[model samples]
Target: MSNMIIEQEPDDELYEHYRFEAGKGQSPLRVDKFLMNLVENATRNKIQQAAAAGNIYVNDVPVKSNYKVKANDVVRVLLSHPPFEYLLEPENIPLNVVYEDDQLLVVNKEPGMVVHPGHGNYSGTLVNALAYHFENLPLNSSERPGLVHRIDKDTSGLLVVAKTEQAMAHLTKQFADKTSEREYIALVWGNVQEDEGTVEGHIGRHIKDRMQMAVFPDGSQGKHAVTHYKVLERFGYVTLVSCKLETGRTHQIRVHMKYIGHTLFNDARYGGDAILKGTTFSKYKQFIENCFKILPRQALHAKTLGFEHPVTREFLRFDTDLPEDMQDCIEKWGIYSKSHTIEEE
Candidate 1:
């Protein structure tokens, strides 16, 4: 099982905090062995290092890795944040910096740009551009420079980058506390009936498909997430909506929307790429295909971001226009809806 690392804090000296409770029928087991069973990608050596740092606690008492975890005992683990294993290479990529000061910078990130280097993406990320543009920025828990929060590679939006460790901590705290505001504009399949509503669920990686996130409505697994949405416009077949996040779990918006039976239009992963709604008529199918061609990715955009300035402590908000692809897709839908309704009338 993937250990749940609470995203409650970030600093130069940040740590990953996790809490686990022994089951009622759980037999006594070595703490490290018990943890190795629960925490994915964690090695015995790393757990030992944390124990050596007095970071492992059993019922408020620090314990060694070999300590036997008894039934009903609460276990808490804190490990120093691990650095990125790969060396960072600066690349001169253009950045759409909306605002900048000594303490921080606000960027209007374009879609299709990965935020950080990992796996197959070792270059051409936002971090690479930031490293080239700025001088001597601080690294966060993930070892990425300046980034406090990130949107998906296909989601365009405003992101804040801290120039200093203190700024990163402050910004991270705001996000963890849910004080920061993030609003997304999305075009979803089917006409959403409710003018506004909220989706509450736990979001985690799918057991079968590790690449996709699945919603656990019963809270049996995954991190708690909430998404509030209001309808912006309604076409006969699709609806545009604005979503506000109460939690920042990975793919929270996408998974929550899908759970509600209105997956985002053209979202290939969540079954939105096909003709999920609308008529069986060939003309309607052609129109839908044309719209999909215009917008190849999920119809979600991080349109606005609000947070307190890390140094000045003043509330700061940034908003950006939807990129051309999404705008074009919405326009096509609007025209198609008008003509289709008129023909029916």
Candidate 2:
């Protein structure tokens, strides 16, 4: 089987740094030695230190460096931090803190804020704000301090940040195991036929366009992703839906909905900005343009997030109201749909 490593370092937590499965007929070997052979630039001393720190796992159980690996044994290296890339400079950007504790905090992120710094976007990110607001927040495997998970830049919602190292590891594991719950409110281009449905496909970078994500139904490429959606409301042309993610991948909902012929409304990257479902009439076109102006970005918002508190182990869930832009757009659509119905009758 192929090893699973998230290379793109997308907008989510990185739990498993490296994973290896020994061959069926492989000879028994020391765990450190086995890893040194497979892991690039890994030394015996480093592996031993990771083992001593309880970061090495064999079949999901912590193992020492000297543990002997047998045939078909699975090995994993989990780290709380990834290789440091940028020197984060604290910026005094204001944050909307919903909840805070000694171990963690939840912030209601606004739209148009990038989660962390990357190429070209080396400043004005959430990480910079976190650095300024909180000193020495624990860094996740992506080297993003305090962030255990992330939503897209234009997708506003709640995100939990770890204040301590213990919280970081604990919360990261919850997300990697797919135990955490996240729900989003989305407006799509077409009227969805089903009230509830599930979309399953492997999501990876587009072959031709590196900036975009594509779905691979054959599982030949990318990581497995699933999105469960429920239709909340349907205008004559567009539909409002709620999507719950089973697996976190970059642009999972946007790509999966597009796969099902219902691209998210106003999602510029996925071609939702165009009037895909509306009429060819100039008035109808102007109405859609007005809605686009009301909601300049994708009509998707991270509405709810649920996870076990890292320190208390109590389940914590946070929900937020839809931003004004989305609400206004939806209301306009409702009015247009009703007026059109009256005219047709």
Candidate 1 global TM-score:
0.75
**How many clashes show up per model?**
0, 0
Model 1 lDDT at residue 20: 84
Tens digit of per-residue lDDT, candidate 1, span 1-345? 113222222231223356788999999999989888887798999988888877787875678999999999988775555433336778999999899998899999888888876424557999999999998898776667998888777888889999988888999889899999999999999889999999999987665554478988888878889999999999878899999999998778889999999999988878999888866588778888888888988999999999998777899999999999999999998887877772362
- Total clashes in model 2, counting residue pairs 3 or more apart in sequence or in different chains: 0
Candidate that scores best on lDDT? 2
- Ten residues in a row with the worst lDDT in model 2? 1-10
Q: Give each model a TM-score.
A: 0.75, 0.76
lDDT of each: 0.82, 0.85
Query: Tens-digit lDDT track for model 2 on 1-345?
Result: 122223244543334567788999989999999999999899999999999987787876778999999999988886655433327789999999999999999999999998886433557989999999999898776566998888888888889999999999998899899999999999999889999999999998776654578999999988999999999998978899999999989899999999999999999989999888756688888888999999999999999999999877899999999999999999999998887852352
Off by over 4 Å in 1: 1-85, 342-345
* Candidate 1 clash pair list: none
